[model samples]
Target chain A: MNGYAGKILRINLSDHTYKTEELDKDKALKYIGGRGLGSRIMAEEVPPTVDAFDPENKVIIATGPLTGTPTPAGGRYMVVTKSPLTGTIASSNSGGFWGSELKFAGYDLLILEGKSPKPVNIFIEDDKITFKDAAHVWGKIVSETTSILAEEAPDKAKILCIGPGGENLSKISAVMNDINRAAGRSGVGAVVGSKNLKAIVVKGSSKPTIADSEKLKEVVKESRGKLKDNGVTGQGLPTYGTAVLVNIINEGGVFPTNNFQTTYFDKAENISGEHLAENFLIKRESCFACPIACGRYTKADEVEGGGPEYETIWAFGAACGVDDMKSVIKANFWCNEMGLDTISAGVTIAAAMELYQRGKITDADIDDGLSLKWGAGESLVEWVKKMGRRDGLIGDKMAEGSYRMATHFGMPEVAMAVKKQELPAYDPRGIRGQGLQYATSNRGGCHVRGYLISPEILGLPQKLDRFAIDGKAEWVKIFQDLTAFIDSAGLCLFTSFAIDGEGYANLTNAVLGTDFTQEDILEAGDRIWNLERDYNLKAGIDPSQDTLPKRLLKDPIPDGPSKGNVTRLEEMLPKYYEIRGWSEKGIPKAETLEKLGV
Target chain B: MKIKVRLFATLRENRGKELELSLQDKATPEDVIQELEIAKSDVAILLVNGRDGDFSQELRESDVVSIFPPVGGG
Candidate 1:
């Protein structure tokens, strides 16, 4: 039982049949767990040519060896599948109690397959499993669905469900858990909807057993102390949540505002972390044994959900040109309740706002008789609600995401995205390495897959000039590999800022008895990255698709520290290709593949 | 010239507020800290014109320099 539940739960929705399979030690060791395991399973079981919404499409939810353990910030889980939005391999990891609960439920992984004829909800209680009719809960919002399920099940049950946005098959849907945490990005919720699965509720009292309990506890204590003493984790994140990045990124001239037309927001101060804390923060919440407690509990009259994080704040506040804290908080709450990705929703709405400003979209398109304008908080909130409900033409187009919306309006270049997924807070043009990560990311323009921002923006490990492109290619590849290890380990990426690869390796080695060295951990990360890249390549994505939008390439930062600068992707791309042991066309070399045993 | 500077996050929250700093003529970052009543251990990054500045980097007159504590980041 050490490091795993030693069982896999398989649920077939079409026949309403459920079964349990033994966990393979070989697969677990090779992939580690979480996103790495999900990627491997999806790549092998589901064909590359299969459509993301097809009946054969499978969704894999996995937790790592450390999940449900006492390791600090170890309560993360990953949802992996072919994404309806990006049309690529998608793996979105989320922080919540659900992963821990799932592990405690006597399953290391949950695999869902086949489409159901009708809606259904799955419940797991340790070794017991039940599939019940979810006809009444199918169309409910995330909050109501979760509340109803929790009431029906045990008090301690953890629920992961979607809302009307997902039921409507909205392209930007997210699966919400713990009422606030979301496995958000690349239409994972739509995949859930495609399977006609309503929700998954789990309750378990089983305790996870570790190989070396004494050694594991020591590592956990040391790691937690490091996180608490670290300046960024101890102070910045806990106090302001991720919203702290607003001011920092703005100063770097990378906080894209007004649909990537501007990098700086004059009114950014009004919607920043400092402002959010000063006005709205009610308390702090933690996931499992996390010491950071970056989750915000806000009590503003207009916003009754988790406070807008940095990405959400940037998406709704700066990108849409609406700097009001109340409006940002309200949008955050509405996105969660409606099961929409706040990052994608905000960027898509911002693109629509730009289209409206340019006379490409008429006022007649908006059902509420609203005039979408830059910095109009009221109009922004109105449109967010309409989009959630899919009310009218504007809502319909907005619900499709920015890439499709841009194509529908005949201005695809203005979408401000990579591979259909909208860009997050950091402007790639300002941070060149992030541009490479976004363009080359398996799931479109995601930051977490390989966050070079740690070095490019914050200078955590070693300070580097944000404006320069020197050694960034090597730096990005290293970060991407290390990040893969963290994601697979089910540990929060935030901890990596303070703890190095050796520290993370020790944590894994202590708990799982894997004897992972720092080099072995990084090599595993590299292998996982290559494996995902291979999957995406097999899915018809090639080197040509691994390119940034024209706007980021051509446009220069208008002001601030990075003024008169554009991303030198031309220089970095070749170097990045070389460092990854890939061909000039970005395909992994045979020797490199053999070395990693991919 | 002398000025009042405030630190933030770990540095400000842990250590007491408001550092009185004295600068030499045509002073840079090195000159300001050398003559100031501030601890070097508490300062991680220097913010001149609200942007990151090197400790050895030069400073100009009327620069609103903010000193931040040695904080880690994501």
Candidate 2:
């Protein structure tokens, strides 16, 4: 139990009872931890087809072996559950002090089962646990809820909670922690809300035991040196934060604009990171144990808070056809306050704008007096508040996400989503490998699942022809499998800029005192990937769902540097299936499952 | 020939955001950066006419050249 807390806390809300179970060491090694362990537990305990909001559905909050340790950027955790948004197995990752605090509380995992008859908050100090009434903070916004809970809990305790978006059961809601950091995808927050649980406050006084302290110290120093020497992790992120990518992506002509109808924004400079640093950025922030410090704290008019990350900026800025940086900052602040996924909320608004443009949504249909016109900054800010509150007819529909909202307007094709989950900032038409990654991502339309953008756009490892089809399937498989490893190990994906498979193996070996080679690390990743894929398949997410939006596949980008390009997914799907050791129909082969023992 | 040159991130500190450069016929992106007094190692991403470009690639009149220092994030 060198790298683990050696215990699992299972809480049954209906009975207001809890049990501490011994950790299974073998399973922890096999699945790594965090997302992998949580997903494995869900696969065994929760039925694949169970409704996401049903009392039977379980929420697993898990931390990896490296979590709360001295490893660089080790403060991370995963929230795994059935997704109400995509109806696929969902595992969302987040960073802050919360994961480390949970580890110190003497549990590797916290499993919430059954529904509470009333709103409640769970508090843990060391091994002590208590359940308290949460009537005062049940429907509050995230910052307010955190403030109230912090006052009631032990001093310096970390709190995780949902906001109005989750309380109203918005399918695009996020679980916010440390006030701003979020496990922000696949509607995991709504699952938390469904149980009538308001928050979890934890404070602890111990550290995770390490097997080889000397080895860990050397590896940590080496890793930290690599991060310091690397141009990206060392300087760029520290200086500009993630918002630096805004101008780079826009210049690449793959910055999605107006909900992907166009590939470029003419006034991108207005919303660029360079401009943010010059005008609105108040400070650079960092999560626990992070050296890159890519988090940004910005202020616009009156609001000040953490982030408007590149994706958030693109979502509310160019994608919605609004170039006002101040409005984008305000929208991001509201997203954190309301516990909404900024990407989904903003893209859903963009889809609604398209619906309005096509006359599917008339002014009469929107009684809230907010215009659906592109670049309507005031409307963007107000609609986010309404979507979080689920106010009015349009707000209620938008709360369900873009695909459902567009389908309600009789045109699901306009949503710009894959598997009913909204796509991120990049337009896949221009980046072929990313297109395949989006289509095949187990969690649906998420960039962090694979992040082909590193090699394809940022040229981290090597640059490939973004439009080329040759060997892209192979690249996708490698990136996806490696990403799975990083997520399970509780490391930030940005660390991949400096660390490779061998480096990850070294870190794991040093932490757990296990002699795992690079090949073993990747094999573990492959196993995790296939397990999630198998779970989704069993849950009725068919192989046909492995596809991009129809617009990306057929219609070419109308204008931009990447104009006249479309995702050639057809040419790569079979190759990807072949590379994954799956059948032609995209089903995992029996041999593959046996080989990985998934 | 005249080319539009764009600088971003740290590269834009002393230099401006954008500039118009005049070069001899058959000037390449290398020449454009040289005209701007930018070190070759300082440029991590180079784009000519919105496509990935090499330092030695010949530039055409009215082509746009974009340059950035080592920077990345999703």
Candidate 3:
């Protein structure tokens, strides 16, 4: 347990009781902690079909062995629970100082179970834990909640909390940490809201012991050097942040615009990363032990805060047809303040706009002074506020997410989502492997599950013809498996821009004292993937849900370089299933599960 | 042939955003980059009319050639 805190902290909200248990060493070795270990615990302890908001539904907040260690960009944690959004197992990740602080507090995982009768907050200091009444801050925004909680906690305590978005149980609500960083997907914050828990403040005095400090020192130096030398991580990211992808994606003509109706935006330059850096960037931010400062803090008018990442920009700017960078920045700020996932919130608004465009939603259906017209930048911030609070009629329905809202309007097809959760910036029609990855992501339409965009578009590790269908299934499987490992190992996915599978293994080996080969590391990733897939299968996420929207699969892009192209998902899915050792129906074969021991 | 060349990220610094480069017929993206005075290594991704562009492939009239430095994000 050299790299682990070696304890599990379980808090029973119903009875206001807590306990500590030993970490399961065997499970840790197989799952590699964080998302992997959290998913295993969810499947074993919680029924797959349980309602996400049920008192019995549990949330497992976990950190990997690499977390809190002297490893490059090893400051990440996973919030694993059944998603209110997709009904599939959701493991949302965030980077900041909280995960590492939890390790220093002597716990590898925190299991929160049952419902509290009243709003409450949990405070932890090293070995001490207390549950304090949080009725005073129950409906507050994220920054306000953090500041209020910080007043009573120890000096330098890190706070993780929900906002009005979660309090109202918005399906797209996010868990905000370190004020601006978010575990922003799959409605995880709603689970916390259901438990009547408002926030958790933690301060730890010690760090996890590294098995081989000397080896870790060497590994750290090498990885940092690699990250520094890499182009995307070293230069592009630090200089322009993740927002740099705007112009690149737009130039490729795969940047989703107008709710995916078109593949390119004529106004892309007005919202490009270069535009943001030149106009509004206040500073660059970095996570613990991260060399690539890809985070951005910006100001617009009177608002100033973190983010408006590439996806956020696309969702609010191009997807909604709004090219005003200032409005997009403000929307991003409101999203963080309201504790809502920017991708989900912005895309949900885009879906509403589509509904309006088709006459499904008329002016009579909207509140006064609100317009659903495309590129309505002035009303974007107001819509975000309503969505977070579930205010008025449209806000209440939108809080349920685009899938439900669109279906209510008798056109679920209008939602640009896979498995109920909205897709991110990249339209999959032009990027074949990315399409397959989106269709098969465990937690729904998530880009990070398997960012095929790297090899497909960025020319990293060599580029592929973005429209090619051959061998894409293999690439999808490998990227998905590797991503699962990185998410579980508590490292930033951005590190993969420089570090390969073998490099990841070396870093883990130094800290954990385990000599795992590159293949072994991949196998571990494959195991994690299967475990999530199995849980989703049992949770009623059918193989049929493993497909993109009809629009993306059938409708050709009307313009841009990707025009005349559609996602050849049908041509690649069966092959993907074969490569994954799943049946034609997308069920994992018995032998395949046995091989991975899932 | 009149090829529209778009520069992005750091590549746009002194080069400006979009430029109309008048070149001889049969010129490729390589010629376009050379005209812009950008190093080949600086061009991590190049697109012609929204598709992956080959440096030596012949360009067409009204082709939109977009060039980017090493840039990425999800």
- Candidate 2 chain B minimal-lDDT segment of 10 residues: B42-51
* DockQ values of all predictions: 0.34, 0.82, 0.82
User: TM-score for all predictions?
Assistant: 0.95, 0.99, 0.99
Q: Candidate 2 chain A: worst 10 consecutive residues by lDDT? A: A376-385
Query: Which wins on lDDT, candidate 2 or candidate 3?
Result: 3
Candidate 3 on A90-154: residue-level lDDT in tens? 99999999999999999999999999999999999988999999999999999999999899999
The chain A TM-scores for the candidates, taken one by one, are 0.98, 0.99, 0.99
User: For candidate 3, lDDT tens digit of each residue in B36-61?
Assistant: 88999888898888788889999999
The order of the candidates by lDDT, greatest first, is 3, 2, 1
- State the lDDT at A558 in candidate 3: 90
- lDDT per residue (tens digit) for residues A243-308 in model 2: 888888888889999989998899899999899999999899888799999999999989999998
Best by lDDT: 3
lDDT of each prediction vs. the true structure? 0.83, 0.92, 0.93
Give the deviation of candidate 3 from the true structure as CA RMSD: 0.9
TM-score of chain A of 1: 0.98
